[model samples]
Target: MAVDKVFDAIVVGAGHNGLAAAVELASRGWKVCVLEAKSTAGGAVNTQELTLPGFRHDVCAMNLSSFAGSPFYARHKDALARHGLAFVPAEHCFASVFRDQSWLGVSADLDTTVQRIRAVSEKDAHAWQAMLADFQIKAPHLFAVLGAPMPSWKLARSAWRSWRELGKEGVAELLQLLLATPRDFLDRHFESESLKAMMAAWGLHVDFAPDTAGGALFPYLESMANQAFGMVIGQGGADTIITAMTGLLQELGGQLQLDAPVCRIEQDKGHAKAVVLADGRRLQARKAIIANLNPQLVFGRLLDAQSVPAKYQKKVDEFRPGLGTMMLHLALDSLPDWTAGAELQRFAYVHLAPDLAMMSRVYAEAASGLLPAEPVLVVGQPTALDPGRAPQGSHVLWVQVRVLPARVCGDALGRIAAGDWSQIKQDYAQRVLDVLEAYAPGLRGKILASLVMSPQDLEQFNPSLIGGDNLSGSHHLDQNFFFRPVASYSRYNTPVKGLYLCGASTWPGAGTGAGSGFMLATMLAA
Candidate 1:
């Protein structure tokens, strides 16, 4: 195909956020074009038949919680709904199983979650309710902070007003909640080790140590609140959200070119001029260029060295990629019979973290480039919530083991590709299966087929996920807010004029596709 005419804007990477930016800009009368390296539009939000002929497995992300609170969902609900988008809430958000065979199920209902806690520790149950109550009081303000760009005058003013409204003591308590680690906070509130472990495991969802600085248990609570309000699965799976965004972009006259890997972002007169595709096609843009990729790939590989500010370059080099994950997608011939429920219950967000000490050890091992002796596994059976995902009477199970170390030192990728999982994947997968078998005994026999995607597979599939670091960048205190991606370019705008970032790598870090697209849209529209 010949190079098209210049577009008002060119979005590199057709991820959800990229498509979102294109849709917003195009809706405002800007001629937009989206370029994707992959064959499909959704970057990580892909669905494929990896397990069986008819089973539709969500390749990467399964939860739509992060995207739920996004402006993309709110502003375009009708369009999304028209594209077959649907959400099914999990009965219990998650269940944490301990080594002693005890478990805690975190329900969607706040009172039910507290009751689950009460089954373990009565005092802790009351404490959980108090925590929820306190957070509810401040949830609106917190949501405002998350919704908008950070370091804004508005955010500061809101913070000041909150301080005044809540009083000095309340402000102090809130600060403590933000700074304390999940383990510390849970230990202080709950006496039972299982209860503490159950709550603390939520912290691991992001790529941070439980004891990492500026770590807090509030992140877990905040995520739960976000889910409670509207964490629905896209009708056909997670990819449905991405498909809706893409459809909207197309409807608004935006163009999308897939299988076009961008090799470099061309610049002229200190401004972004165009992007050079691997096929030697230079697609030019008139107004701006947005990158929906990780900072390392965007700065280190895409942009020329001279175009980036020296300080920003240094920070990009130092910015750590968060945790790595190993995912197992299974196609079961029949549903696993469980005492909890005969039909796969939405309450089956299962966790295999034994205790706080064990969870801590898991992180320590992952950081040291060694697989955890006993890893934590999180499982979700979306097929239970939506049966259309698989063949009749069959099911699909999505299992993920977070905080796995990227086998960087050795030829781990080669070994894994060669079917040798370095004993890590083997041991971890078996452990997860053992947990499943015990809870749902016939689960092992019901497995018709399974596919495992190592961290290497993630990187290969989406180069933006450097070393399988899904968050784009770490969510550590040093890398968040003003320091996100880099301090000088925190507002989605880069030092290179007219070039902006619209991906998970920007502020708010990962999981939620909140910051990049909306921030870029607001800035460009202004």
Candidate 2:
């Protein structure tokens, strides 16, 4: 590649969204170049053997269900599959172990799930069936609202279609459901505290705690979707999709430059022209420059002060990152023998969040800059469904501790005096292990090797995860929907004429859905 090569578009980051955007444009006859700072692509979708060789762990994301069902995958599934993409399905979706040594899990088989629910509350069993039936009617409407561009005509059309299909009364009911908190929503539907806790764990996957408004949607969507579609992970690792996408991009005449860190976006009179690399190499963009980055970096660091408007800069500065998440990857001799039940080993994720009250406490503690005494752990047992992720009989544990402070101030349990993550990550990792040990006895003994990634470590690895917020920015009602990143700039376009933003920071927010990238491509290509 020539030093002064001018492509039709230059993608700033080679995250999944950036790759999706680059591939989409290249397929439409646009010459694209994707520059990634990291040696590897995929960003949060990356997979690495952090624990040991042959023990492949998804460094950030584990589940690929959202990516599998995304519009981008739907459009290019054949190509991706041809490029060595595959998935391993798990019939058992997720489960939660209670302090009472009891657990509740959701399975693809409706009867199996109902039986588990009936063990706790027969009434809740009936409620579970009703919600699944209701989900059939609501999923399409809800997906329409979520799939369309925020604050666009497509979005208005989706709302109108929902009105026509759901009618006035149905639409009113849907609005109430969207505004309700997880606790409130669960209270109306289920009686078993354990059952509610099992479903509510899905909310914490983003930034929503039990009481967070607009939190009900994720719990409802994930629970119902998992029951309907089951869950699927990459065949070997989560990076399969990334590898496939990049391969397809190259085949389509798109260029990917790894370890090419963009220092800043060069602009001329409010028009983004090129990106200057950290090594002082400039690659010009003939038409557009798309930044798949945190909004703060795109505005606060990349674009020069004179190029960005003062008001726009203020909005980016005020953008709130979600509570940080810590990653714990372990190469285990075998899966834990759960005290709740051995059946837990069959599920993809086992959440160690006993109840809604605990969820609320964890959120409050992290929000107050205090290290949570008992952090909610999302224990991902990928080997249960995909043995190829590790050597035969061995397993990899992907434990994500959610809702930790970005910058610690104090310890909720008063056990650790150090506030810095460097000094306290190991101590905090042990606390998470203790939490798991309560549900899965002798869990610690199975560990052959372990790798702990603090919030700081994640941010250093990938800058988009500012403060290690995997969702990139908070998904609260005020910061999400049409108000994401900025109120008026929800459609990927920025104040600069040819510079656009994509990735987790844009509307439709986090997860591996690739909605922001695909949507942005459609707009630009049109």
Candidate 3:
């Protein structure tokens, strides 16, 4: 812990990936130190009392859906358990209510889920079974892919193994599934509008259109499958995961410094030597410097432009953040009632896109930098499941609407500069409240406190979420895979020697911080 002591590695950014990387390195006997700009860890996986006293709300990322399937969590569960992390499975995963008052609830039990679907259409219920079966067969390999780095030969080997196990026809079916859009995929199998909408809404969680090419929708469906496998809430909310990771790192002699904003990564002989902090302090390292920051931030701002490769620089400029989202955290006096089941006290997570056409319109309007007439809303009432989050009869609601543009343009920026953005936010919040009221009556009056975070606030809180995009970069085919961040640097290791990338901006774009940290650890271990 000496001020001048050199560590084996220095991890920039205390996000999940940064914590995971530090833990992995420390576990391997490498002396590590993590630098965080924020006083607390858990970048997006943080919980706070943003509203009234006694109301604990998860500011971002409510579900451990991705964490459930993470090999990192599986391997480190014992260590994590000591830090107070636990999981609670919901009876129902999600409920999507249509404009017409029809609803579809995805249950933890596949049979129950099928029955729920059958209420809408028997044929669709059967199709739902087939989809689950197919996913069950393919999920293991898919999960493996998600845990490792992209274009990995190891992953390719697993794919080959799955191919052999599934045979040619099954392989063909998998290929077809990957290529088909969610809209077409659902239409071919389901007849019920509500059932199709529910599935499509789940697929659109990443804020991508169901019709986007290269079938990006598969990952969202895969996310649901992963969640259903081992859906458990962490002990003290998502921050516990970060706290556990930090504890693990500390146990292995890894060091961490909070409120240390890294201004630059100093290099020597084409390799990272140390990080320059904003306070003008230089902390040197001997082995590697891992950046858990967004690729755009790492390359575009933190590293000296003269030292970066021209090609990489171009890609850094070109890298596009995925759609940003508006997060509304509400502290309510009571839980909202659902029409599907009166017994439902909490919505584990709710999907609000009613149908494919509605979803398409939402995407279209968002793409144009305008709020949708009916935005796709994802809601989570963690207090319903974890009463400890609030006082008796109180609840906390986390609502998010994926938006196209992270920043306001000409007129909108001007409006914000002129204090009109507050009005805009109020207007938008009302729209969301109106939707909530229609689906769950008496929701508005129960609000004792609320906080609205614009896209600008999100970027300010986490620079990695550039343009307020939580996904790092768009998951579009052009920006994914070998093309991610840039073509040659998609594997977490960057062009700068001993400097790496590990955030949502890397491969597997966003939602679920499982892949980035695990993959970076694997690469470093190798």
Query: How much lDDT does each candidate structure score?
Result: 0.75, 0.92, 0.75
The deviation in Å at residue 462 for candidate 1 is 1.0
User: Once superposed on the true structure, which residue ranges of model 1 sit more than 4 Å away at CA?
Assistant: 1-3, 217-219, 222-230, 337-345, 408-428, 431-442
Instruction: Indicate the worst ten consecutive residues by lDDT in candidate 2.
Output: 299-308
lDDT of 3 by residue, 169-203 (tens): 87776667656777777677778888777777765
> By summed lDDT, which 10 consecutive residues of candidate 3 come out lowest?
410-419
For 295-401, candidate 2 gives per-residue lDDT tens digits of 88887688776568899898899999999999999999999999988899999999998999999999999999999999999999999999999999999999999
Cα deviation of 124, candidate 2, in Å: 1.4
Q: How many backbone clashes does candidate 1 have?
A: 1
Model 3 regions more than 4 Å off: 1-3, 215-230, 339-344, 408-423
Instruction: Flag clash pairs in model 1.
Output: 86-235
TM-score, one value per model: 0.92, 0.98, 0.94
Report the C-alpha displacement of residue 382, candidate 3, in angstroms.
0.9
